[model samples]
Target: KILSYLDDSGSGRVDLGMFYAVVAPLCGGHLDKRKRVAFEALLWRPVNEGGSSQITKMDAVKYIKLLRAIYIPSQGMSEMLEVHGEADDDTSSSMVTFNQFLGMYDDSEWGFGIMSTVVKLETRDRNRHGNQVCSVCRYPIIGSRFKEVKTGFSLCNQCYSEGKVPPTFKQQEEYKFREYGSEVEAMKAKCVCFSMQSHKNPIAT
Candidate 1:
């Protein structure tokens, strides 16, 4: 269906507007107005250069590569595929079908959460302790304002209070506090995992 939109020029190319029309549904209208502008920046190509203002199949490949770098450069494509076991065959066509693209996210528990660009509170864990540190800030968490998540990671209160924690790493709640011998005691409590939160209000990616 996206290929069909490239028919606008009858030249086997898709303009920025046409491409956006094809992808708008995937975005679910959650993109902000400013974000739309940033997208234009990503889509734009100098006409004076070899390529035209419109996007061709080759141009789309280049854009996808750049997008991959911006979004998931930390995780190599091969590593991600291996971890998720999404692609069974080692060798496949470079082109991705629409269903394949959607399936990539559908297959993972946290894939949609990361792709949606909204972080939700993770479940709490109590049984684990010691030498745990905030993944984001790399600070100590024991005997201070500390919290642990299902990931078996700890974060200090200062980082949480400062709002420095990314949504992906934020805990839903801290350990429950109990008064013991004039000191506050924190006990690890168990909580069930829940669904990801909605990003009806999108933040700039």
Candidate 2:
């Protein structure tokens, strides 16, 4: 199903650009790149199945609901989809063109927040594990764990959401964390840093 959606050219094979258009949105990179990829994903359709490229309000609502399912799981789907009061009388206003969608990112603060959350959730590892424990709660980390770069402090998703940090470290007004899927990945990053440093300052006999 995803392949069909991405194969806009209707060719049996998906080209590198086509594949990147759909996959980049989930990989959590530059915000502009993610936004562009997302916009393409929403507008894409096989050339054989020609249709308007503009996304309707309903389309936007459905995408929003999918995001809500991850971040706001407690909220019922019906409640999220419900339209408040009467529907918009202006029919044309309900459609969002590519330019209009881009405008939302430029004009709305929450625009960046929403897209960032979407990328984070899509890229997160949903697998449960006990290989590592959260530094704050001392519980086995599940899914994605957030680690502070400066102090090597880690937090489980719940603790991160609640803004919990290691008691030894002073709480800051804001915290920056790198999300990792597993302890091995964190270790690999450490090893890479070590290798780079070693290259820069090689030992002399």
Weakest ten-residue segment in model 2 by summed lDDT = 83-92
Which regions of candidate 2 fall more than 4 Å away from where they truly are? Answer: 1-130, 171-174
What C-alpha lDDT do the candidate models reach, one value each?
A: 0.39, 0.62
Write one digit per residue (lDDT tens) for candidate 2, span 18-91.
35443554565687777677667666634212577776554444444443443344552454444322245453
Residue pairs that clash (backbone atoms under 3 angstroms), model 2 = none
User: Residue 93 deviation, candidate 1, in Å?
Assistant: 18
Model 1 deviation from the true structure expressed as Cα RMSD, one decimal place: 19.0
lDDT of 1 by residue, 36-143 (tens): 432344345452134333233333333343333334556424333333223333322243333343343344542322434431211112212344565568754533
* lDDT (Cα) of model 2: 0.62
Evaluate residue 200 in candidate 2 and report its C-alpha lDDT on the 0 to 100 scale: 100
Candidate 2: deviation at residue 15, Å?
A: 50
TM-scores of the candidates in the order shown:
0.23, 0.36
lDDT (C-alpha) at residue 123 in model 1: 12
